[model samples]
Target: MTDSLGQQKPVNIKALLQACRSKEETFKALVTLSKTLPRLSAEKKTEENKVKGCESAVWLVVEESHGIRHFKADSDAKLMRGVLVAILSLVEGKMLADIQKMDLKAELAELNLSSYLTSSRTNGVLAILNKINTV
Candidate 1:
């Protein structure tokens, strides 16, 4: 991925997840990007999109148009929002078929991301993955 001038585009969280240097740095980056996820509209924040099994309420909305999935999410907790952003970074704009082929748990494990989270929060991430993959 590049710009018109052929400069390498900044690697996204998906790439960051693949990096081996410092998992803490990658988690920090996820947290930073988490702040960028826009708040879901009142109309969009419904039970249908809400994720379960988390300490906080997390809502994820998956929409597909022309075979590409658009992921939108929000949470009352910052770290959970980071989780949502990380999830969205992996799959947003990707085709459903492509997303289905992804092994998110392994990717997250590669970063040792679970170490930064509680077991239940980790399970929440799994639930988020289930929601995204099922869509």
Candidate 2:
């Protein structure tokens, strides 16, 4: 996908997953990606963008251009921010129908992240996906 800067690149998921020989490696890679994710300014992270069900304050805003959704998200916690970036990597810049067709749960499971999350965090992921669908 091309970013706002018009730089063409594939989503980092597959490569990062493949290169991670251990869970620790995967976590490190995800953290690095999270740090690079676009962040919302304090002004943009208003109540309107706040997502429920997350232990930390999480916010998301989506805009559509030419039928593709572009997501901007942030979280007060590092891990949640990483998870949000991973989720956005899959759904952003896709058509709503295509996003809906994706089995996000299974995809996340493949990353071996779900088993490591608390129930609340899992619910937060669901809430994020639901919010994306609504957009």
Candidate 3:
């Protein structure tokens, strides 16, 4: 496969986030992030709100307040939930124009998160962002 591709992808050497962080810290942050998730009732977890490309069950809901978009997202996977929180935290109170202009890849990468995500998870992030932009 590498011979066909011509070159192997350069491996990133960053420590996995889950490895560096304590389980207690992870649990606490997850609890806080989940508690802060914009209210998505159980009834709202229908196919219409689910992010299509995510391997995990991710549901997103948006409300526009005076041109600012407030996004509420949830995922069954703990990792995905954290990703949602990281992305949503940026645009939560910002204007739509700001959200559109935001470089989430750079932002997430700077936080050393991009290295931890698998290709599918990265795709899921894109899907989540696309849903935000379109809606």
Candidate of highest TM-score: 2
lDDT of candidate 1 over 28-121, digit per residue (tens): 7667756777888989889888888867899988888899887778998877787676667667778988988988787666544666678888
> By summed lDDT, which 10 consecutive residues of candidate 1 come out lowest?
1-10
Write the residue-wise lDDT of candidate 3 on 42-108 in tens digits: 9878899999998889999887879867676778887677667667765666687787798867766
Candidate 1 Cα misplacement greater than 4 A, ranges: 1-10, 14-28
Can you list the residue pairs that collide in candidate 1?
none
Clash pairs detected, candidate 2: none
Ranking of models by lDDT: 2, 1, 3
Which one wins on lDDT? Answer: 2
lDDT of 1: 0.73
TM-score of each: 0.79, 0.86, 0.72
lDDT (C-alpha) at residue 37 in model 1: 77
User: What lDDT would candidate 3 get against the real structure?
Assistant: 0.65
Q: Which residue ranges in model 2 land beyond 4 Å of their true spot?
A: 5-11
Clashes of each: 0, 0, 0
TM-score of 3: 0.72
